[model samples]
Target: MSDNVTFDAIVLKELNKPLELVKGIQFPDLKKGQVLVKIYYAGLCHSQVMEARGHRGQDPYLPHMLGHEGTGEVVAVGEGVTKVAPGDHVIMTWIKGSGHEAGGCCYAGPSGETINSGGVTTFGEYAVASENRLVKKPEGIPFDLGVLLGCALPTGAGIVLNDIKPEKGATLAVVGLGGIGISALLAATTFDPERLIAVDIEQSKLDLAKEFGATHTFHAAHDDWEAEILALTDGKGVDHAVEATGLAEMIERAFNVIRPGGGELVFASHPKAGDVIRLDPFELIKGKQIRGSWGGSSKPDRDFEILADLFRQGRLPLRQLLSDTYTLETINEALEDLENRKIIRALIKISEPPADAA
Candidate 1:
């Protein structure tokens, strides 16, 4: 493929509006530290939904590409690129890794205007990504399943293994059983927690959480849901409470369910702008700590391999997290399913895999 090669992409032409499936977009010439990748599968995450709804802030980059988690094959590498070569299957992620970090790309739009894209954008048939944003996919892993390693797995599982580090036999609760929440719940099971409580408003999510090793499941809509968790923990509370729902009220509630002494709450959600989480200062005085997680503070170069190994061993129930799959043409429908909480995780098939490749 050449710099003038035309491809298709889903663009955010307007805020709080449906994405525009624009075709015949020209790929920009690869700059230093950039790699051209043929995107195969992309994961639909809440972050994209938030951005599309203008929940986080103003839209400085209208007509920008959206998506940070995906699986692709390196079609070309630019100058100074060494971490990966052409034909190397890779995981496209927003997080930085080992390689040269290049700036965003500019593509020729269908209407002769320029389309803005970040270092890593996967809701398209092809992407020009920073070298540091791509990690070589593990051998023999299904490309569709490998897409989670780009974001959900690293953030969710990384929180359990790297951030919270719950001790064996400890009690833990995961609020909001979304993709990230369930990933955390799955990771917690490896620690042999005495009780793993899954909390969610939807019963379907709660049922799925049980299949992911949740020892106890509670519907957050119930008036006594917190009480149920408290009772499970002998009225003290869990040692660690993970808040993955980007809602302010859920964040506060997650903080309230932590044990009085030396308890910790780690939130991975990106709440809407001006949505403040009000917590009692008194809780901090009692050694209750609350902190936001940035992709589970993960080092993808090291953690993605570990997660892949877990998946190979059949220890990580990743397939169960995949609720649905859609084509790039139906990207809006996929996003709607996600926003409506009708799926755990939706995979967008951007392009077909090569005949020789898996």
Candidate 2:
């Protein structure tokens, strides 16, 4: 296997600080079941913000690399790799897919120290990902939009399609209008939900949700927001409620507004380490089901194809969900926009896609 390639990357040297933009990071030799990729675009999710802020608890792996969703082209493959090949366009994701789940990679930092990374990290010009963490990018999909398929699309869309599987004409509400929540709204539209109500604090997000096919939109900041949702369902409450915000209050509110019997709640957010949610036992006893979603229990190998087909047919509206794009030099700005709720979804252009990628 050839070696001696170096690239620029963003490293989290400490908690609650701007990531260190280090150049000339040396790539270690390919380990078994690894694939080297030339990254094109990556998506910034709220989970990375929590990790950067030290909200996810102890940081045993300080000075590590970050980011989990990206679109790239395979540059090389390690031993025992069979799922993808050189020059193949792929989505790099944290969700393990069809191939081998290789261990994390170690990149040599400029100061001669080892920078630890997970099985997949994408905020860089190049990345080494486990074979199972990649799925082939379908023809005719833009690489930029393909980044969303890596995480938000699967997690949000999957929650409705795979986990909840709400019946046609069912009433549904999606709280939080970020990428994941908006993706859920898009997916819910396809189910022919009788009422797809969107809840968010931002009018901009609600407007965007309506454009993406929400039957109604409500501002969550309203004191009677929950009541309004219940009113929409004729005082019974929605048959399904999906909460994508990691906030405990929102999670509780989502659970409280579901119909008593056979109502389903799926919280897709990754809550902070010390955060706990409280639900009344009476509600549980009444068959008000509640559960957390792990990437919407997605099977990337199969689901990616379905989502890509939807995008191609213009049903998914993947492009409308993107709010802004920034290059690696302005990644901190991207993170701030995400934290401030200024953007629906932030895309980081780590490197230009190959000329023929389109």
What TM-score against the true fold does each predicted structure earn? 0.98, 0.98
Off by over 4 Å in 2: 1-4
Give the per-residue lDDT of model 2 (tens digit) for 84-193: 99989999998888889898999898878999999999999898999999999988888999999889999999999999999999999999989899999899999999
Number of backbone-clashing residue pairs for each candidate, in the order shown: 0, 0
lDDT of 1 by residue, 1-358 (tens): 5554599999999998989899999877789999999999999999999999999899897879999999988989899999999989999999888999898999988778989999999999899999999999986678899889999989999899999999999999999988899999999998999999999988999998898788888888875778788887788989999999889999999898899989899999988998898989998999999998999889889999898888888889798888888998898999899999999889998878766664
TM-score of 2: 0.98
Candidate 1 has its poorest 10 consecutive residues by lDDT at: 349-358
What lDDT score is found at residue 120 in candidate 1? 96
**Candidate 1 — what's its lDDT?**
0.90
